[model samples]
Target chain A: MRYLKLIKVFIKTSAQETLMYRANFWVSLLHAFLNLIVAVLALVILFGQTENLNGWNLSSTLSLLGVYLIVSAIRNLFIGPSLEALVGLGQEVWNGQFDFTLLRPVNTQFLITFRIWRLFSLIDLFLGGAVLLYSIFQTPQSPNLLAWLLFLLALVAGILILYAILLAFTALVFWNPGYLFTWVFDAIFQLARYPLGIYPVGVRIFLTWIIPVGVITTIPAQVISGQTGAPIVFLILAASVFLFLFASWLFNKGIKQYHSASS
Target chain B: MNHRGGFALIKATWFSWMQYRSFFFVLAFGWMIPPLVALFVWSAAAGEGSLGGFTRGEFITYYLVLVLVNQITYAQVNWTVGDIIREGTLNHWLLKPLSAIYQALSSELAGKVVYLIFVIPVGLLLAILLKPEIQTTPINFVLSLVATLFAWGLRFAWGFWLAILAFWITRADSFLALQDSLVFIFSGMVAPIPLLQGSLQQIANILPFRYMVGFPVEILVYDLSNKAILFGFLMQLTWLAIAVLLSRTLWVKGIRHYSAVGG
Candidate 1:
């Protein structure tokens, strides 16, 4: 409960920073719309040639893309911005300014993970939700309330999986702050924009188990499209919980590994 | 342009950038994922059957070659040109002994050299494992190389001009992001140009985007008529010329505008 209020305060301050750059909102809106158009255009062209790709059709794939956008927006909103403040290009750890963050009264992980935000990404969140809604309606059978509940559960799992993965990568900054470790992760994450089944078995296994980007987007999409079982959803929820705990442990280990750059 | 000075600058840039080769390699791998995803998706779609005149083997070859072509022509340097202009760093470039372009050019060449070190081996490994089928004459290969050079020139000049707009507008990077989306859609990254239907095919053929990365790959992989290859080259050269003109004009005008603001 205390953490929730802290997040609200963090968001309020971030909102003030965002509002100072009004043009950025318009730029972000345009970027979101352009990204949507590109995604939809690609789908239109792909589906135009073949009715379905592997077992996934255009609508199901669009659902995956929508989930991808939502996950990405959520990352951009807080997960990306906050962690990026610590370890991104020319950021805190790079410049030895992270000592200031460590000196704060709050927990280091909690502060670093929630203190900064790019509110402009809220535009992408709305656009993604709209796409998901539209794609859901386009399906032959609309999701029932239970399906919606499952979808939300899977979506939350997906987001947590992504967060854990990013947090693990962010923690690597302690070992080597010069390299942007998240970039390699970003490359792998791009694969999540499509259904995992479309990849070769070997590649699919790697993305699903090693990186789990497949679990981050494909499972939630599968739930929305009514292609997944409830057990699988709960299984993913458990897996995400485990991954989060492991990542938190790794972050704490990394915190201990941190040596002040200034000294 | 002083050829000796430019050569020296590129050497210096390459050695300086060697320290960050791993980062560039990761970025290159990220750039390769989209085409790799397309390759797998199209190959799976074409299992036991063809999609839009492309067999599974042909799809494999097309995207394998495309991975190399896309990496070669991609203008990663242009991403920083806007920052250089906006952050008052352009003044440093202006005072350099070599032409201002050498600053951009050196980084561009060094980045390609670094990125290709990773991209080529991965592409070759994928090709060997995937077993891409190819039947191209030496003449076709030579023409494809020439087309690739033209494509790089067109893409670099076009993106440079867009970045130069930072002298007038604070948010010129938005335009760069918009251009990337357009290129991804029209440049046959999503699907082979041959697979595109009616108006979309015509639009892609007419746009400068296809001339950037897709035309060269299409030349090498697709069995096109002489007239079609000639037309592709013609369009590519025309766009390159136009882009060069625009880049030159924009730099001159933008420098005047920038100096006025500073003065």
Candidate 2:
């Protein structure tokens, strides 16, 4: 409950900060629209060549893209902005301002995770939802109530898994403050925009087991698309929980290694 | 222009950039993801047959070369040019004895050096593993290299002009995102231009965006007729000339606007 209140305060402050730059809203909207157009155009061109890609049809692939957009928007909304401040180029950890964050009474991870928000990503979220709904209608399978419930659960797990991966990358910043580790992860994460089955077997296994970006978007998409069942959701839920706990442990260990520049 | 000063600047930039080679390597890897994803998707679609005259092996080779070509031609320094103008740091560059353009060029060359160190090895590894179809003659390879150089010039000059627009509008960086979307669609990143429909193919041919990254890759990967290759080069030169013209004219006008705004 205390953490909830803290999150509200953090969000309020973040919203206030965002409101000062109203033009950014328009810029983000235009970017979101352009990104949607570009992604859909790619799908259209690909579908023009063939009926399906590795069993994923135009509608299903669009769903995967929709999931990608939603997950990306969520990341941009909080996970990205907060972590970028904490560990991105020449930011808090590099400049030693992270010491202030550490000295605060709040749990460092919780505070850092919720401190900053780019509200403009809300537009992206809306656009993603629109695409998801439109794609769902376009597909032959209409997800029932139970499938929708599973979709929601899998979506949460997907978000958690993504957060864990990014957090793990962020922790590496403590070991090498000069290196922007998340950029590598960001590259791999782009693979999740497509169905994992399209990749070669070795690369698919690597993305699924090593990075797990494959499942981060794929499983939720699979469930709602009526390609998989509830068992997969449980499996991914376990993975998400495990990944989050491991990431938190890594972050804590990294925090212990910090040597403040000011100190 | 002092050739010695330019050489010294590039060398100094390279040395400074070496300190963050790992970070740049990560960024380069990230840049490779979109093309890599397309490669897998298209290759998988081409399994056991051909798509638009491209076998699975041909798809692999096309993207593998594209990964290298795109990395070489990508103008990352253009992103910083906007910040330089917006933050009023252009004044310092102007004060330098050497041309201010060298500052951007030095970083661009240095970054390419750092990034290619990582990109080339990975591209080679992929080529070895995937066994991309190598279908290039000596003459074609040499001509492709020239086309790639022209591509880099066009991409850089085009982006430079967009960045210079920062002197006139506070949100000029948005144009960069717009440019990226255009490149993603009109360029062969999404799909090969030959694979595109009649009108879309014509659009791709006409757009300057394809000349940036796609033309060079296609030149090396595809066995184009002599007339086709000549047409590609003609289009490449035309766009490069236009880009250079725009960049030069914009810089002069932007500088005037900058001083008028008391920059």
Candidate 3:
């Protein structure tokens, strides 16, 4: 309840800040539009050659693209903006202003994560949603209620996994203040844009198990698109849980390390 | 304009880049994966059958070659130019004895050298592992080198001009990002130019973006007719000229428009 109140305050503050810059809205919309065009054009060109790629037709690929866009937008909207403020600038951490954040009567992670919200990030979500709906319509398979449920679950799991990776990277900032790992994460996100079935066997295994980029958007997209089963959902959910726990543990350890380093 | 000063700057930047070698490697790894994914997808799509006149081996060669070409031609300094101008750092650059282009060139050269240190070894490794069919002629190889150099120069000039617009529009970064998306679609990064449909291929042919990354790859991977090669060279020179002129115009106009505000 307290965090909810805090998030509300943050959202209100963000809304005011966003409103002050109306140009951001247009720029963000154009960015999403440009991204959509590129993704769609690529799909069109790829499908022009042959029909199905590892049972992924143009529609399935479009859905995958949609998921990729939405997931990336989610990162931009909340996790990226906030984590960047924390670890990227290192303004608070490097200059020891993060001391003030620690002294605050709130959960530091929660405070950091929820404090910044880019409302313009919704433009990508909206665009992604449109693409998803259109692609779903084009797809021959109409998934049942169970599949939809599983798809939503897998989506949540994917987002959690992403956050876990981000949190772990930010935790490392306590030790190495320079070099944002988020750039590395941004690069990895490109791999997740395509289905893992395309890569060689070695890469497939790495993306699926090591980084979980394979499962991030692709598995959820597959489940709902009728390409895979509900069992994959459980697998992803388990991975998400394990990753979250590990990331939180690492973050706590990093805080301890920070105190020791400063002392 | 001072060659000795430029060499010193370049050397300094190169050494500075060595400090952040790991970060660049991480970035290069991220960059390498997308083309790898495309390589696999196209190979799978071409499975035992040619797609758009490209054999499975040909698809592999195209992407592998593209990985090299794209890596070599990519100039991402425009992403920073907006920040430099917006923050009034461009003022300091203007006051420098040597040309500001030399400073930018220093960073550009340093980054490329740092990138290639990782990119080449990885390329050779992939060449051995993936066994992409090697196709080349002595003449085509020489032409590819020339085309690749021009591509880098053209892309950098265009992006730099776009970045200089920060004097007139604070949202110049947004447009630079949009230009990147255009390149992603048209530069044969996603698919070979021949794979695109009639109008799309035409657009790619007309646009300077194809010359930026795709044309060099095409020259190396496919046996183009003499006419095609001649047409490509013409396009490359024309675009390079236009980019230079546009950048010069923007540089002269933007300086008059830019002044440090309130600080």
Error of 1 at A124 (Å): 0.9
Write candidate 2's Cα lDDT for A71-108 as tens digits: 99999999998998877667898889998999999999
Better DockQ candidate (2, 3): 2
- For model 3 chain A, give the 10-residue run with minimal summed lDDT: A254-263
Residue B230 in model 2: shift from native, Å? Answer: 2.1
Once superposed on the true structure, which residue ranges of model 2 sit more than 4 Å away at CA? B260-263
RMSD of 1: 1.8
lDDT of 1 at B174: 89
TM-score of each: 0.96, 0.95, 0.94
lDDT of 3 by residue, A163-230 (tens): 99888899988987766678877777788878888777888888887777777989888987987887
Instruction: Pick the DockQ winner.
Output: 1
**By DockQ thresholds, what CAPRI class is model 2?**
high
List where candidate 3 sits over 4 angstroms from the true fold. A260-263
Candidate 1 vs candidate 2: the DockQ winner is 1
